[model samples]
Target: MFNLSYTKSFMIKQKFTIEVKIIFLILTTVTVVISLLILFFTTKEKELLITLGISPKEIELFINRVSQELILFLGITILVLLIILSILVKKILSPIFKLSLATRTVASGNLDYPIELKTQDEIGEIAKDFTVIERSLKATIRDLRERNKEIELLSKITTKMTTRLNSQEIIGLIIEDLTTELGYDYILVSKLSEDGEYSQDHIFSGDTQMKQAIEDILEEKIENIKAPVSKLPFLPDVSSGKIVIKERLADFIGEVIGESQSDAIQLMLGAKNFVDVPLHIKEKPTYLLLIATSKETITKHDKDILHTFMRAASIGLENALLYEEKTRWADELEKKVEERTKELEEMTAKIAHQEKMVALGTMASRMSHELKNPLAIIRSNVYFLKKKVPMELMKYLDMIGRAEERSNIVVEETMGFVKGVSLKKELANINDCIEEALRSLSHELKKVEVEKEFSEDIPSVLIDVHWIHNLFTNIFINAVQAMEEEGVFHPEGELIGKITIKSCVVNSNIEVSISDTGKGVPQDIKDRIFDPFFGTKIRGTGLGLSISREIIEKHKGSINVFNNESGGATFTVVIPIPE
Candidate 1:
C-alpha cells in the first residue's frame, strides 16, 4: 500500500509539466514527418522527370539538383522554426527569470525592490502577485518597527512611573511621554471617583492659548453671576465635583466601562466613538479609564493597548492614593499619641496657618462677589459707550470694557476660592476663550509684541469658566511683569521682546501655554513662586499663582511653572473636559 501511494504521489508531481512535454513531443514529430516527406517527394519527382524522356545524365543532374534544393529548403525551414521557437521560449521565460531573481532577493531580506513585468499573460499575473507579496512584507516590517518603538516607549514610561514617588511628577511624565514620544496632541488622565464621576486630576501636554481661553471663560462666568457677597462661589463646592456628561456620554462609558453598556446611555448622551476600560482593584471597579480621540472609530488593537496602559496606570495611581491616605492617617495618629511640648507647638502653628487660610478665603470670596456687580456694570457701560459713542473713542471704550472684564475675572476667581464653588461645566470653545483673553489683555499685551498660534480644529471642553479665566489672567499678568522688569517697553531697540500664547487640545484635555522673551524667573524663587504669599516683587501680591492654584484645584485642574529652554518663564495649565 505504501509503495502504491508513493507511486501515485510521484505521478501527481510529474503531472505539473504535462503541457510543456506535449508541446515538445508535437514539435519533434512534425519535424521528423516533414523531413521524410521532403526526401520522398524530391526522389519521386527526379525519377518522374527521367521517365518522361529526359536523358539519363540529365536525370542524374536533375536528381542531384532537386536533392540539393530539397535539402536547402528543409534546412532553411528548420533553422527558421528553431529561431522562432527559441525567441518564443525566451519571451515566455523572461518573467519567470525575473520572478526567480526577485524571490532570491526577498529571501536575502531585501524587500524594497519590486519586480516589473509587462506581459499580459499568466506570467504577468504571477509577477503582480509577487509584487503584492513584496508590499505585504514591507508593510509588516514597518508595523514591526512601530511596535518596537511603542514597546521602547512603554518601557521608559514604566521605569519613570516606578521611580517617581510624587503623583504630580508621575502624571507629568506620562503626559510628556504621550506628547513628546507618542506625538499625542493632548493627554489627560483623570481619576474616576467612586460615584462614576471624572475628576480632573492630571494633565500633561497642552498649549498656552487653550489654557488662557479656559481661564478667561471661567473668570467671565463667575463675574457675570448676580450673587450676594456672603454666598460666593468657592473651593469646597468645586473640588472633586462631578463632570456633567452632555454629548458623547455613551461613547465615553463604552470606552471606560465596556461596549455592552453603550445602549444604556445612548439616549442620555449621543456618542459616535469612544473607548473606556475599567481600572479594577480586587475585582471591583475602582477607577474608569477613558480616552477620546478626534478619530471617528477606535480600532481593536488600540483599545487593547490602551486597556493595558490603563491597568498599569491604575496600579500606580492606587498605590499613590493609598500612600497619601496612609500618610495622613499616620500624621493624625502621631498628633494624638504625642501630646508633648514640641508637638503641641508644631500643631499650634499648623492650626494657625489653616485658620488664617480659611479666613482669608472667606474674606476674599466676599470681596470678589461684591466687586463682580460693579465690574459688570462698568463693562456694560463701556459697551454702551462704544456702540453709542464715535469710532474715534471706540478703541478707548473697548479698552475700558476689557479692563472691566479683567477685573471681573479677578473678582470671580477670588469668590470661587472663598466659596469653594465648582465651575458650571459646559462645552466651551478653547480658541474663542484664548481670543477673548488676549483681547481683554490687548492694551497690556500690545505693549509687548504678542505672538499667537491657535490650532483651528481644537475640540471644545467641559469645564468651569471662572477658574480658567483666573488661570489666564495670572499667567498673562506674569508675562507683563516679566517684560516690564526687563525694560522691554522702549520704542527703539534691536531686540524686540515678545510673548507667545499657544492653545491646543491634546489627548483628552485642553492645554494652554504662555511663554515670554524676558528675564526668566530667578532660579532661587522658581520652586516657591506658586506658593501662597511668595512674590519676588515688593509691590506684587504673591497671591496670583497661589490663587490660581486654588482655583485650578477646585476645577480638578493643574498649573505648572517652568523656565523655557530658550529664555523666560513658561506657565502651562491643563484642564480636563468631560466626554
Candidate 2:
C-alpha cells in the first residue's frame, strides 16, 4: 500500500518541516548517485555487448531487466528513508513539544509550572532563558501587588486625615491604621508637658504594667533631652516625640528606653524595629508619633507614609487646640452675657416696680378726693333713709349701709397698697387666720372641698395681724372662685374643684402654699394677676391681690404665683419668722 501515516501525524503536531526537508535531501542524493552509477556501468556494458556482437533483441531484453531492478530498489530506498525520518523527527520534537506546552502554561500565570525539557539544544537554551524571565517576573509582580496594597491603604488614610479636624480623632485614626492595616504591635500618641516632659495620653497595646513602666522611662528620658525647639539650627532628634531616631533602639531593646522595660516590651509584643516620626504642633513641642512593629522591620515606604501623616497630624493638632481655645472663649463670653442679661432684667424689674408704685400712689391720691364726695353723699342718704323709712323698709336701709361700707373699705385698701398703711400687729395664729378666711368665704366653699396640710412645727411669722388676715382672705377667695362647679344635686354632683393649703417652716421663713384644682390660670393672664384693677371677677375694683401682695411685702415677705400641676394656680407666700 502506498501510505505514510506517521509522518502526517508529526506534521500536524510539531509543525517542523525538518523531516520533510531531510527526506527530500536523502532522496535527491540517492537519485543522483544511482543515476551516476547507472550512466557509468550501463555505458560500459553497452559498449562491451556491441563489441561482443550481441543481438538487438537480447540488448533490448537486458535494458528492460535493468529498468525493473532500478524501480524495485528505488521503491525500497524511499520506504526505508521515510521510516528513518519518522523516528528521528519524533526523537527531536519530544522535548520541544513539552517546552511549547510549558510556555503556554507560563503565559497563563502559572509561574511554578515546570519546563521538563531535558534536551541540550537551541530549544533547551530558549527554555532556560524563559524560566529565568518567569522567576524575575514573578518577583516583580509580587512587589507591585504589595506596593498597590500600601498605596490603596494610603489613599484611604489620606481621605481620613483630610476629612476630620479633630486632633484626637486624627491621632486615633492614625494609630488604628498603623495597627490594623500596617500590622503594628504597639503605638502611643503622647503629648509633652510644658516643662519638656512626655506624658502618655493613649496606649494602644501590650501589658499594662510593662507599658506603664516604659512610659515612665520615656518620660524620664525625654526630660533629660534638649527640647526640640525651633530656636536650634536643627531640631534635636528625640524618640517618636521628635525627628530623631536614636541608633541604640534598633540594635537592642532597652539601651535607649530602659533595660527592664525594653525586655518587657520585647517579651510582650514581638516588636523589634521602632520608628519615631515627630509632628510639630503650634501649641507645644511635646507632640509625638510613636509606632512599632512586631514581625517585619518598619520599611522605608512605611516611614514615608508616616512622615506624611505626621505633617497632617501637626495641622490637625493645631486646629484642635485653636478650636478648644475658641470654645473656652465662647463659653466665657456666654457666661458674661448671661450674667449681664440677668442684671439688666433685675434693674428693669426694679424700675418697673417703682414706677407702678408711683403710679398707684398718684391714682389713689387723686381717686380718694374724687370718691370722698360721693361717699359722703352715700352716708347722708343712708342716714336719712334710716330716719324717714318705716320699720318694714329698714332692712333695705341696712343693705345700703353694708354696701356703702364695703365700697369705703375697697377704696381704702386700694390707696393703702402704695402709701404705707399703719399696721395693727399682734401675735396671731396663722392657722386661725386661714380658718377665719375660710369661714368668711364658707358660702362659696359649700360646693368646694378644702384640704389643709399645715405644719404644726412652723415658727410664728412676724406680720401685722390685720394685713395677714387680708392676705389669707384674698388667697382663699381666689381659690374658691377658681374651683370648677359641676351640678346642683348630691350624688350626680362632683365638686368640680378642690383647694389645698400647705404650711411649713422653710429655713428662716413660715411658708404657706395654697393650690387649687380648677381650670388652670390662663397662661396669658398669669403675669397680670397681681396688677391693680386687673380683675377676672365681675365685681368691684381688682385691688384685693394687689393689696394682699403689698401687705406681705411690708412684712419683709414675698409672694409667688404659678400653675399647679394637677390644675389651676398655686399662690405661695413666704413670710419671715419673728426674730
Candidate 3:
C-alpha cells in the first residue's frame, strides 16, 4: 500500500518521463528527415545545373544561397516543433498536477476536495485510481472518527454509571447517555421479573409527546407496560446473550403490545429500526435495553458500540443490585439487634421487679406477724378495761380500742398488698358496697359532708365484695386525709370539705364516681400516681392507689383519677357488667 505522497510523487515522475520520451523521439525523427531531404534536393539541383553547362562559380553561388535558405527554414521548423512539444507536454501533465493537488488536499485532511479529471489515457486511469483511493481514505477516516466517538461515549457511560449504586438511577443514566449522547431517538429499559417469566418496562426516555402517544395507544402507562417472555419471541434470543435487531418493528412490537396498537404507536413514534441488547447481572440476563430510531439503517459499527455500552451498563446494574441487597441486609441486621436488645432490657426489668416484690413480701411477713400479736393483746386489754373503768375512763378505753383497730387494719393492708389478694366473686350491689365503705369511715367523716347519688337501676355486679370494699375504703381514707390536710393549711377558719359518691350504669358497666373537695393530684405526677410507693403524702405506705389499681385490674375493670370540674379530684371506677 503506497502512501498518497509516494504514489503522487511516482506518478509525477512517470509523467515527466513520458513527456521527455515523446519530445526526444519527435525531435530526433524530425531532425533526421530534414537532413535527408536537404541532401537529396542539393544533389539533384547540382546535377541539373552541371548538365545544362552551367559555370562552377555560378553553381557554387546558387548552391550556397539555396543551402542558406533551407537551413534557415529547418531552424524555424525545429523552433516551432519545440514550441508545440512544450505546449503538448503541459497539456499532457495537466491532469497529473490536478491529481497531485487533490492528493495533497486529501492528505491535509480535506476529504471534500473535488477530483474532476476525465481522459482516455494512462493519466485518466491514474486519475480513476486516485478517486478510488480518495473515497477509501475518506471512509477509513470517517470510521476512525466514529470509533473514537464510540470510545468517548463508552468512557462517559462508564464514569457516570459506576458512581451510581442505585439500580433505577443507573438505568436512567444509561437511557440519558444513549439518547442524548449516542443520538438514539428513543431508549427503553425493561427489567425481568423475579420469576424470570415477564419483562416489565421500567423506563422510557424520548420525546415527551411521543411517549404520551405510545402510552395512550397502548392504554397503559409506560412503566406499567409488561409482557410475558414467551409472547415476545425475540426475548429468548436476547436473554441468551445475543443482540436482537428487528426491522419493520411493528410486527415485533405487535407481539408484545397488540397488533392494532403497534401500528399506531409505530406511526406516532416514527420508529423504523429497533435494537435490543441484554443487560446481565451475575452472568445472567436480567434486563433488556431497547434502542429505536426513525433512521432507515443502523450500521454494524453502531450495533457494536451498543453492545459495548450494554456490557458496561450490565456491570453497573449488578453493582447496584448488590449494593441494595447489602443495604437491606444491614437494615435487617440493625432491626434484629434492636429487637434483641429490647428483649434483654425487658427481661432485666422483669427480674428486678421480681426481686423487689420478694423483698417487700419478706418485710410484710415479719411486720404482719409482729404487729398482729401486739394489736391483739392491746384490744383485749382495752375490752377488759372497758368493763372495769368508770364512765369518764370508758371514753379513754374506746379511744384505745379504736387506735388498736386502726393498727390492725394497717397490718392487714400491708399483708394483702405483699401477698396478692384473692377474690371471692359474688353478685352484689355496688351501692350497697359504697354504703358499707362510708359506714366503716363514719367515725372519721364527721368533719366532712358526705353525699351519695346511687342509681336504683344499678345492675348486680359479679365481684369479690371484700376486695371492692377494700378498694373503696382506701380511696375514702385518702380523700378524708387530703381534706384534713387541706383544712390545716387553710388561711380561712377551715376548708369546707365535701365528698360526693355517685353510682350509675354507663356503657354497659357500673360507673362509680367519688368526688372530694380536697387537693387534686399534681399534673406532673398524674401518670405515675398508680405506681407502687408513689404518693404526695409525707407519711404513707404509698400502696393505697397501687393496691386499688391491682384489685380493679384483677376484676377486669379500670380506675382513673382526674381533677373534678368543681374542685379537688374525682376517682372514677368502671366494672364491666356480666353478660
**Could you tell me which 10 consecutive residues in candidate 1 have the lowest summed lDDT?**
234-243
TM-score of 2: 0.62
Error of 3 at 224 (Å): 24
Model 2 Cα lDDT, one tens digit per residue, 333-387: 9999999999999999879978886887788878876887898799899998899
CA lDDT of each prediction against the hidden true structure = 0.64, 0.69, 0.79
- Clashes per candidate (backbone, < 3 Å): 34, 1, 0
User: Candidate 1: what lDDT?
Assistant: 0.64
Model 2 is weakest, by summed lDDT over 10 consecutive residues, at 227-236
Candidates in descending TM-score order: 3, 2, 1
| C-alpha TM-scores of all predictions | 0.37, 0.62, 0.69
- Residue lDDT tens for model 3, 1-579: 237677667766876786677878997899899989898989999999999999999999999999999999989998998899779877876777787778767776788887888887888888888888888888888888877877887988887888799988888888888888888887656666765433445545555555555445344533334574345443324545667877756456655554434434655446777777778788777776667777788878778888888888888888899999999999999999999999999999879977997898798889898999989999999888888889998878877887886677678678878887788999999899999988877877867789999999898888989889989988998998888776643365655688999999988889999999887887899998887767788888788888899899999999999997766899999999978
Give the CA lDDT, 0 to 100, for residue 443 in model 1.
72
Write the candidate numbers in order of decreasing lDDT: 3, 2, 1
Candidate 1 deviation (Cα RMSD): 33.0
Every candidate's CA RMSD: 33.0, 9.0, 9.1
Best by lDDT: 3
